[model samples]
Every structure is written in structure tokens, then in C-alpha cells.
Target: RLIQRAKRFWPAFVVAGLANALFGLLDAGFVMLLEPLVSKGLVGRDPETLARAPVFVIVIVALRGVAAFVSGYTMAWIGQKVVAEFRCQVFSKLLRLPAEFFDRESSGNLLAKITYNADKIARTSSSALTILLRESAFLISGLIYMLYTNWRLTLFFFISFPAIAAVVRVATRRFKKASHNMQDAMGTMTALGSESLQGYQTIRIFGAEAQAEENFKKTVERFRRKFMSMIATQNLSTPLIQLLAATGLALVLYVSLSELQSGRLTEGEFIAMVSLMMASLRPLKQLSSVNSQLSEGLVAAQSLFDILDEPEERDSGTVDLPTLSGEVVMENVTYCYGENSPALIDVSFSVKPGQLVAIVGPSGAGKSTLLNLLMRFYHPTKGRILLDGHDLESLTLSCIRRNMSLVSQTVTLFNDTIRNNVCFGLKEVPSDEKIIEVLKQAHAWHFVKELPGQLDAMVGEGGSNLSGGQRQRLAIARALLHNTPILLLDEATSALDTESERHIQAALDALMTDRTTFVVAHRLSTIQHADMILVLEGGRLVEQGTHQSLLAKGGVYSRLYRLQFGEPQLGTTTS
Candidate 1:
């Protein structure tokens, strides 16, 4: 895939490479010409020619330098363009992926691919590609010049080229191995940083700050060691190539001198031959070095492709129902987070419009699981869920989500102004009056208006600037802004204090006026007014009825109510 993607920039790359080759050929011609001019003017005592050699060499060097510069700059520009396009494509794919993909992967790992792995390709494209073009062109031009000078000597030097290639091949393997370790270590460090920041409150509450820091430091140190090791391996390729070049240069001079002394070659031709041989070997050695870096670059490219090739959301594209009535039916739904470990079992329920139903369960019961199913984060192992009598799978996932609003136990907000967080999903810019009304309905407007910047006040990362109750209010406000007919509240008030819960409950009471709501409640008192209360245990619905009827029956619901809210009154049958 990377190769196919890279082909998009091939035209520019080829042009830049050819420019570099032409420059190398010009440089070699000028250098070879010098040998003759030097021999004719100095050895043969031609003073006029000797004076002109310096001037001619200067002009050739300047022109060739300009060509090399243009070639390098153009290649870098092409590389940047290709990398930009590649990154944009990757980001687009990420956004288009289904919610289930996020459940199975870490945000930190994917983030490393985007920020670090993509940067690696960019660096490789700019510098490694420039080296590849310049060295390849120099090597080719140098080889042609050497063969033209003396085929016999060129063959002798060429014999060692394979040996240098072997050394480079071995060294590059080590560099690639080290590069993998380095990238993995860097990912580990990134994960640790992300975890620490995301769980800062947990670490602080548990007084594990020191341990967290130490863990983070360990990952950083491992990354440092791995990258330094890769650098060491990459650097060794250069000196190793130079050693081979020096050995070959020594052999060539010895053989050429012997040939000249035997009258098999003229002094001027031998001088030119020696100059051409140096030019060829020099570039070949540089190319050997570049070969190692480029090989490591391919390793990074492979890592990038590993992410880009991930399976995306599999939509059949058969139907795209945009709106849904507030009616949901769950028929014999069975689900498990892992194989053989049930989370929901043969669960069946129905919610009609304007009905407030609460799902009450123990800690391990499948209250949240039911909500996840309705949202299509995970499909059921058996049975189906229908929205307004239409199968959820038959409709586009985005279309289903647009008509529903979910307020989970944990509130998620970005580091943005208060108004933006409240009006998150509105494609068109929402009027300030609408945002203010929603905030007021969610009981968030009073405190928000009290703040210095009011609606424009910046919420810190994940709304860190707000209190827990304030954050929950903001999240409720977000749901109100969405104004979907179907509302899923999964322990939305479970984490709040009593006062905050009361405040939020009042807000929720107002918001639930006409919506079909599914409430996952842990606190029994919260669901006393619910039209229907279903009790779950071991992934199965044990008892379901109105709070008063369940109390009369004296079943599991009554048992839970007594345990949580203390014993209930007699004759309080179905409200």
C-alpha cells in the first residue's frame, strides 16, 4: 500500500533524480578534464593551460552545485507533499472507523502512528531520499567514467563492491531491528504519558504519584536506549563503507601505476583514470551508507502500513435511514464481553415513547451492556434490537446514533470553550440563545454565567476546570442540545454526590418529558418515580414492574430497595 501510495510522487522524484544524475555527470567530466589539463600544463610544461584549469574547475563546481541544490530541494518538496497527503488519508480513515475499533485499540498507540510514525516517514523522505538520489546518481556516473577510463582496473574495483554491499546488507538488518525496538519503546512511552494524564485524579487519590512517575521514567529511558542503539548501528555503516573504499582505492593506484610503468598506459590517461576511479568509489561508498538509512526507513514505513491497513467499519451500504421514532425493542438479546463469560443473557425489553424505564442491577449486572448493544458498539450473540420496528443493523450506524443521545457514567469533554462543548454535534453554528436554553435546562447555565468568560470560558482538558457535578451538568447540556428522542442514561448520576444528583435529577426530569428514556440506575431512590423498574442479576432479568408493584410482590426488587433505601411501606402497589 505504501509503495502504491508513494507512486503518486514518482514523477517529481524521477525528475529530481535525473537532475542529480546530470549534475554528477557534469562534475565527473570537469574533474576528469582537470587530470589531462594538469598533466599537459604541469608535467608537459604548458603554463597557459595550467592557469586556465583553476578557472574552469571553479565554473564547473558552481554550476554543478546549483544543479545538486535544485535537485535536493525539489525532491524534499515532493516528499513533504506525499507525506502530507498520506497523513491526511490516515486521519480520514481513523475518523471513518466504527466505535468498536476504539474499544479494541488504544488511542495512544494510534496517536503514535499519526504523530511519531508519520514524522519518521517525513524525515526519511526528505533526507534519506535526497541522499538516495544524490548518491545513486553519483555512483552511476562515477561507474561509467571509470569504465571509460580503464575497463581492467574498473573491474578490479567493482569486484569489491559486492563485498561492501554484503556488509551494508548485514548492518542494515541490525539498524532495522533496532529501529523496530526504538519505535515500540517510543510507543510504550507515549502510552504511559497518555495513561498518566488520563488517570491523574486516580493516581492522586490513591497517592501513587511517585510510582506513576517512576513508571513513566522507565518507559522514557527504554525509548532513549533503543533509539541511541539504532543511531549507533546507522552511524557504523558510513565508516565501514569508507574502509572498503580506502582499500579499493589503494589497490587501484597500485595496479594503475604498474600498468603506466610497463608503457601499457600514458601518464595523462593514467592520471585521468585514477581521478575517475576515485569519483566512482567515493559515490559508491556514500550510496552504501544511504542504503542502510533507507532500509531503516522502510522499517518505519512497514509500521505505518500496519496501522493504515487495519480493518475499517464494514457497512453494507444497503440502507441509510436518517430518522427514528422513539421506540426500541430488545428480543431475546444475549451478549458476552468475552467468550463464555456472559454479560447479558436472553434479555428482552421494550421502551415506548415518553416512557421512563430504569434498569436496576448489582455491580456486575448487564445494565451498561444493554446500553452498549442499543448503541451498536457491540452486536448481540443472539436475537436483535429494533429501533421503531426497524433492525438496527439494517440502518446506517451514524443514522442510528444521530437520533439517540447517551450520557454515560463518565463525562467526556474537550479542552474548548463552554459553548462549543455544549453545542458539539450541530453542523451549522447554533445560536447563542439555543445554547443558553439547553444549559439552563440542564442546570449548567447559572454557574457558567457566573464565570468571568461565561459561555466563552475555556474548559481545561476533559473539563478539568469544572467540578464533577458541573462536568455532569455540561454533559447533560450536551445531550439536551442534541435533543434526540431516544435517551440512554447509563448510571449518569451514579458518581455524583447527593446534592449534585438531586440537581441533575431535576434537570433529567425536565429533559425526559417526551423522550423514550432508558435509565441504568444503581441507586434505588433515583428510580422510585420510573414508570417501570427492571431488576437484573447474573445477566438475566429476574423481576420487572413499577416500584410500588415490585414492593408489594416482595421480590428481588423489594429486597434491593430495602437494602438501599431501607424497608418500604405496605399496600404501595403499582403506582
Candidate 2:
């Protein structure tokens, strides 16, 4: 299958193969030069021919050198091409895979496929291929020369053939098994390393460094064991096969000596024959070593192919969704994660355009899952959701998502300038003046302007250089710039201080005036003025009504509010 795929680059493969073969054939032809030098030049006293031998040797060596260069350079080029192409395919597949797929798989494993496994393919394409083609040519040429010199003696050399074949067959299976184990171990090691680095602060705080170190050491030891196992197999088999072939060479040499004693072979033929056979041993040993590279490449290829074969997210919708008025409706919706109990069950709700619907719930009460459904990240397992009276499933995923902007609790900022982070994924990128106005609206421009580079300052990875409040404010700024019809804020202001939260709430109030907004909040103070609040508990809507009304009822929302504020001051809507 890999070779068939490589046929796409047939021109390069052909050039590299032919050059490698010519190099080996030239080497074999070089050995035959000795026959003439011994018989014709020395014995026959051909002074004229002997005089030109240096030039002949120089020309053959020069052509062989050129062939080696062309072969090595071109094969390396093909290897690089293979790595680039496979990485691109894997990367594209990652972008299209469903969110559930990402949730279940570790990121480190995916990364290894693109980096380490793809590199194995390169080694196979270049060095492994070079050895296979070039050595076979050299070995075949030597075998032919041996036959021409003394067919009877060459017949004895074939006695060790089955043993060499059997050894290679056993070694190949072991090599492949070791390669698979090594690749999987490498992925686990990568995952462990990434986790330790990313969670370094927590590790230090908890003083669990020893535990982390112990776990990493175990994984490293596993990887090393598999590596050494492969090496031991390769080393043991190479010499054993060499010894077997040497036995055949010994048998052939004994026969040749007897033939020489009987005057059946010339002195020049014997010398040329010995040199070619000795030369043949080198390529044969190298060929045995090629199995390791080929095995690794094969295992890596299967790993990459598995990723490529996974089905992409199902996007069967074709209908166009017009600019939404943000009226969202869910009827008997149910969702479950894998085989677990449904997160949201038979839930139904409707909110008109421009309504600030706050979904308040306990930790596992499925508040975030509601927002996830709204964003079309995961389809409801058993029910339908509609936006502006249009069934969400009938609309393209892009169309459904384009009308909403999300600011989740965990902010994600790129390692780029603040301006780029603020305007991320906006179809119509706002100008500097507009961006500043949006940042000012979200109350983030104050800190941004005080920074060294202001709007152009680098955020660093995940906005690590910024404070938690500043990151939240920047995310709000980005959502404001998005300027979509429907806004989803999952604890968007959770990181802000009381004073900062007040300021951001004022900004959000202004931004939410004409758009439909959903706020999933635990802070009862923030949602006091929400036009309608849906109180969810145990994945069911236990209560739903205006904030003042729900508070007056003294139900779940009322209890939650009193728990935070210590009392429900119902008449005045104050944060």
C-alpha cells in the first residue's frame, strides 16, 4: 500500500533506484578489473593495456561516485517529501474530526503520529530503500560473477541460503513487534512529559515532584527496554547470518582450492572470485540490518493510516441559515456522554430574541452542556433544537455557529499580539479604531494600553503573561468584537474581582441590549437583572421565571441566591 501511494512520486523513485543500481553494478564491474590486471597485464606482459589501467580505474570510480551522490540526494529528497505529505494529511484530518474524538484521545499521541511516526516513514523511504535496491544489485552482480568463474563452486555457496532466509524471517517478526511497542511507548512518554510541564506549578505547589518523576522514569524505562530489545535482535541476527554465509563461502573456497590444484581454474579467476565474494558479505550484512528500518516504517504507516481512516464530523446539512434573530428553542432534548446517564433529559425551553436567559445550576447539573448544545459542538442525543424557528440540524455547522459568540470560563489566547487575539475568527476584521472601542467596551483597553506594546504586545502562550482577570477581559473583548446575534457566556466574568465584575456587567448589559444572550453563571449577583432565569437541578428544569419572581417563590434559585447574598433583597435589583 505504501509503495502504491509512493507511485505518485514515481519519477523521483525511478531516478533514485536506477542511480543506486548503477552504483552497485559499477562496484561489481570494478572487481572484475582485477582479472584483466592479473591475467592479461602481468602474465601476458601487455604493456600498452597496463599503461591505461589507471585511467580506466579512475573513470569507473568517478562514475560510481556520481551515481552514489545522485542516489543519496534524490532518495533523501523523496523521504522529506513523504514526511511533509503525511503530516499534512494527518493535520487536515485532525481539523475535521469530531469534538468527541478529541475528547477521548490524548493530544500527545496525535502529535507523535505527525512527528515521530512520519519520520520513520522518511527513513524507510530514503536509507531503507537505498540499502535494499543498491545491495541487491551488488549481491546479484557478485553471484553472477561467481557463476561465470566457476558454476560448480557457486553451487556449494547456495547451501546456507535456507538458513539465512529462516533467520531473517524470524528477525523480521520480532522487529515489527518491537517497533509497535516502541511507538506506543513513545506516545505515552510524550503525554507524560507534556502533562508534567503544563502542570508544573501544581506539581510544585503539592510537592508531588517525586511522584511525577517516578512515573516518568517508569515510562522512560519501558521505552528503553523496547529499544534495547530491537537492538539485541538486530545485533544477534546479523552476526549469526554472517557466520552462516561465511560457512558457505568457506565451502566454496575449499572447492575452488581443489579445482585450482586440479588445474581447472586460472589464478586471476580465483583472486577476482574471492574479492567479489568478500565484497558480497558486506552488502548482505547491511541487507539484514534493513529489516529494522522497514519494520519500523511499516508500524508507523499503520498508525498514521488509522488516523486517516477515521470518519470526520457528520455535516449532512445543506440548507442555508439566514442571519438569526437569536430565538432559541429546545424540545425534549437529551444528551449523554458515552454510556453515562444523560446530562440533560427531556429538557425544553424557549427564549425570544434579545432575552438575557441565565441558566443557573449546581456543578453537575448540565449548565455547560446546554451551552455546548447551543454552540453545536455536540448534537443532542435524543431531541431537536431550533434557532429562529429553523431546525439546527438542517443548517450547516458553520452557519449555526457563525451567529453565536462564546466566552467560556477557561480563556484561550494565542501566542500572538493582543490585537490579533481580540479579533480572532472574525469574518470582517475590525480596524484599529473599532478594536480599541470594543476593548474599551469590555474594559480591557485600560490594562492593554499600560502594557509595553499596548495592542501589539505579545500575549505569550495561553496568555500566560496576563493576569486571570485580564485574560477574562480580553476574551470578553474578543466576544464583543465578534458582534454576533447570539452570545454564550459560560461564567465569562468568573475571574474578575467584585469591582471589575461590576464594570464588566455594565459593559455586558450594554452589549446584550439588542442581541439574544445566554449566561451560565454561579454568581447570583451577576444575574439579578436577567430578563428570564432558568433554574436547572439534576439535569431537569426545576424552576423557570423572572429573577424577581423566582426569588419571590423561595425555590431553588431563591435558595441559591440567599446562599450567596445571605438574604434575598427582592424589591431592589442591585448587584
Candidate 3:
């Protein structure tokens, strides 16, 4: 995937590789120049050689510097661009992924993949590749020079090559394993830190600071241990490889010195050979170090690819309804999470246009599950849902969602101006007048007006600057601004005090006046005026009627209402 993304920058990479090769050639040329400068200028006392050599050396050095800069800059550019594209693809995939995927994965791990892993990939794709190529060129050119000067000595110098290869191969396997473990450990550390930071208030209120700190410390320690192992492998391999090179150097020196005493090798040739051998050692050491970085990059790339390959949410519906008539019906719908028992069992209900329907049930009685199915966050395990007399499966998901607005107990707000949060995702930006009107209708304009910049004030992360009731009211205002034909509320006012709830409820009454609204609330009194109410127990719909009618029937709804309101006297009317 990285290579595919880098296609547009291939020319740049090619130029970089050629430039690096040229740099290596210059290195070798410097070694070759030493022989002529020493023999002709110093030993032979040639004035012409002395005068020309300095200019030749200066020109070669200047060209090499330019090549080095171009090679480094181009490789860095390609690496950054490739990783940027990869990160974008990952983020886009996250947006398209099904809700179930998120349910099983941690946000911190996903974040690490986008940030930490991407940087590792950049190092591998650019810096590691540059070092590998440049060093390989240097080593190859140095060897060719050695062979030209003295093949017998060059052949002896390669005796340690096989042993060095064996050591590197073993070290490569260890480095890869360590890299994988470190990546996993880092993800765990990120998850621990994210959880603690996000829930710091809860920790403080509950006096669980020590527990949180301990958990975070454990995760960090694990990451540190893994990181140290990786460092050890990386540090050990370089010196070990260098030691093998040193052995080869010692043998070459021993042979060259003998040849020098026998008059078979000139002083200039001997020095040139030694200088080339020493120059090659640095590149050899760098190549060994790069193996660890390459391993880290490969591990990160694999993790990112796993996310990119995940299947996106299925959207098979072809019909695109321009508008919905606000009628909703569920027929024998059943759903189960995984292999667990069904969350909703043979449940069914219907609402006509402009009707107010309330769903009241105990925890785990499928109140929220019903809403999820309606929103198409999950498909029914059996039967189907219909909107405006058409199966919901027949209409595009976007069309179905666009016609409905949701206000839940937990509201999400970005760190942006209040206006943007209220008008979030709208095709056309809402005017100031329209924004204020919705806020007024939702009973939020009073507080919003008192804020520093009114509608333009920043809300801070997750609307942390606002009180819970204020945030809830802002969410309702957002929903009202959507002006969808259907409204779904999941305990929209449950988190507020009685006074706040009453004020917000009044605004909701107006908002629901002309829309089909489905509400799930635990507060029995809140739904007494609903046009129709459905009572659920243990995933089954036990009763359906107007609140007064259900009370007259003396079924599950009556028992629940009696429990909340206290048992009615035998002679007194339940209502």
C-alpha cells in the first residue's frame, strides 16, 4: 500500500537513489586520488601534481555534498507523502466501518496505528531505505576498488563475510519479535493513558486515583521493558558486526605490511587499500543498525494494513427516498449480539404519521436495541422494519437516517464554536436567526445568550465548558434545527433536574408537535401524555395502549406505574 501510494513520487525516489550512488562513487574516488597525490606530489616531488590535486579534491567534495542533500531531501519528501496518504486511508476506513467493529476495538489502538505506527513506517520507507541503498553502494564500490588494487588480499578480507551474515540473520529474527511486542505494549500504554485522562473526573470523585495510577504505571513499565529489549538487540548487532569487520582489517593489515617490506606494494597503494577498507566499515555498521528500524516499520505497516483491509458497513439498498411520511413499523423483529441470547424477541410495533410513541422498559429489556435497529446501526436477526409502508431495507441507509433526528442523554460536541456544533453536518449553513430560533424553542437561548460570545462561543472538548443540562439543551436545539420528520429521544431529559427537565420538556413538546417521535424513558410520568405507550419486559412487548388505558387494563404497564406512583387505593382511579 505504501508503494502504491508512492507511485506519484517514483521519479523523485529514482533521482534520490541515483544521487546516493553518485555520492558513493565520489567516496571511492577520494580513495583513488590519495594514491596520485602522495606518490606524484610528495614522493616524486612533482609540482604540477601538487597544484592540480587540491582543485580536483575540492570540486569532488562540493559535488558529493550537493548529491547528499538532494538524496536526503527527496527520500524524506517521499516518505512523508506516502505515510500521509496511508494515514488518510486508515481514517476514511474508520468512518465507513460498521458499529460492531468499533465495539470490539479500542480507540487508543486505532489512534496509535494512525500516529505512532505511521511515523515508524515513514522511517522505514525513507530513512531506512536511504541508509540501506547508500551504504550498500559504498560497500560495493569499496570492494571493487580493493579488488582492483589487490585481488588476493581482497579475497582474504571476505573470509569473515559468512560469519557476519550468520550473526545478522539471527539478530534480525530477534529484532522483529521485539518490535512486534513493543508495538503491542505501546498500544496498551496508550489505551491506559487515554482511559485515565478521559475519566479523570470519575477517578477523582470515586477516590480511585491510586488505582488509576497503578494501572498506568504497569502499562508503561511493560512498554519500557519491550523497548529496552529492542534497543539491546539494535545496539548489540552493530558492534558485533563491526568486530567482525575489524578482524578482517587486522588480517589485511598483516598481509599488506608483509607485501610492503618485500617491495611488492608501493607506500601509496598500501595506504589507499587501508583507507578504502576503513571507509567501508562505517557503511557496514549502519546497514546492521538499519535492520532494526526496518523490522519496526514492517510491523507497523502490517497493523495498519489490517485496518485498511477490514470490510466496510454493508449498504445494499438502492432506493433513495427524497422524503419520508414519518410512519414507522416493526414486524416480528428479533436481534442478538453475537451468539448471546436475543436482545429483542419477536417484538413488533407501529406508529402513524405525527404520532407520539413512548417505549418504557427495564434495563436490558431492549429499549435501546429497538432504537438501534430503527437507525440501522444493526440489522434485525429476523423479520423487518418499514418506513412509510416500504421495507426499511428497500431504502438507502442515508435517506433513512437523514429523515430522523436523535437527542440522547449523552450528547457529543466538538471543540468548536457553538454555532458549528448546533449546525453540524447541515448541507447549507444555518443563519444566526435560524440558530437562535431553534435555541429558543429548545429553551437553551437564555444560557447561550449569557455565554461570552453567544452562539459563536467555543464549547471546549465535548462541551466541557457547559453544564450537563446546558449540553442536553444544546443537543435538543441541534435536533430541532435538523427539522427532520421523525425524532428519536433516549432519555433526553433524564440527566437534568426537575426544573431543567420541565423547561426542556416544554420545548420538546413543540418540537414533536408535527413529527413522529419515539421516546425511550425510564420516568413513567414523562410518557403519561404520549399518544401510545409500549411496555417491555425481558425482551418481549407485554402491553401497548394509552397510559390511562394501560392502567385500566391492570397489566405490566399498570404494575410499573403503580410501583413508581405507589399502589392506587382499590376505590380510587389509577389515572
Task: List, in order, the clash count of every candidate structure.
Answer: 0, 0, 0
Candidate 3 lowest-lDDT run of ten: 566-575
TM-score of each: 0.91, 0.95, 0.95
Question: What's model 2's TM-score?
Answer: 0.95
lDDT per residue as tens, model 3, 1-575: 66777788879989999988988888888887887788788889999999999899899999999989999998999899899989998999999998889989999988988999999999998899888888888788888887887887788788889989998999999998999999998888888899899999999999999999899989999999999999998888889988898899889998888888888777887788888888878888899989999999999999999998999987889898888879999999999998889999998888999999999988889999899889898999998999999888888889988999998978999999999999997999878999999998878898899999998999999999999888988898889999999999999997788987888889888888879999999999898999999888999998998999998898888878887887774458854
lDDT score of residue 528 within candidate 2: 81
Clashing pairs in 3: none
Q: Rate the local accuracy (lDDT) of all candidates.
A: 0.80, 0.91, 0.89
Once model 3 is optimally superposed onto the true structure by TM-score, how far is the C-alpha of residue 167 displaced, in angstroms?
2.4
lDDT of 2 by residue, 1-575 (tens): 67877888899989999999999999898898888888888878899779979999999999999999999999999999887988998899999998899988899888887899999999999999999999999889888988988898888887898999999999999999999999999999998998899899999999999999999999999999999999999999999988998898899888898898988788888888888877878887999999999999999999999999998987888877667888999999999988999999899988999999999989999999999888888899998999888888888888877889999999999999999999999767778999999999988888999999899999999999999999999999999998899999999999999888888999999999989999999988788888889999999888999988997797898889887877645555756
The alpha-carbon RMSD values of the candidates against the true structure, listed in the order shown, are: 3.6, 3.0, 2.5
Predicted candidate 1 versus true structure: per-residue lDDT over 1-575, tens digit per residue: 55677787787777787777778777677767856685788679888888888888888888788888888788778767867887787888888776667877788877887778777787677777676666666667667767776777778776667777788888878878887888788777887899899888899999999999899889989999988887777677767777787677778787887778887767777777767666665676567656656765677678767657877776543556666668888899999765668889998888887899999988888888888888887788899988888887887877877888988889999999998898888787689998898888777888999987999999999888998878988888898889898899987886678877787789899889888899998788888999888889999988888999998898788878876865554545544
TM-score of 1: 0.91
The alpha-carbon root-mean-square deviation between model 2 and the true structure, to one decimal in Å, is 3.0
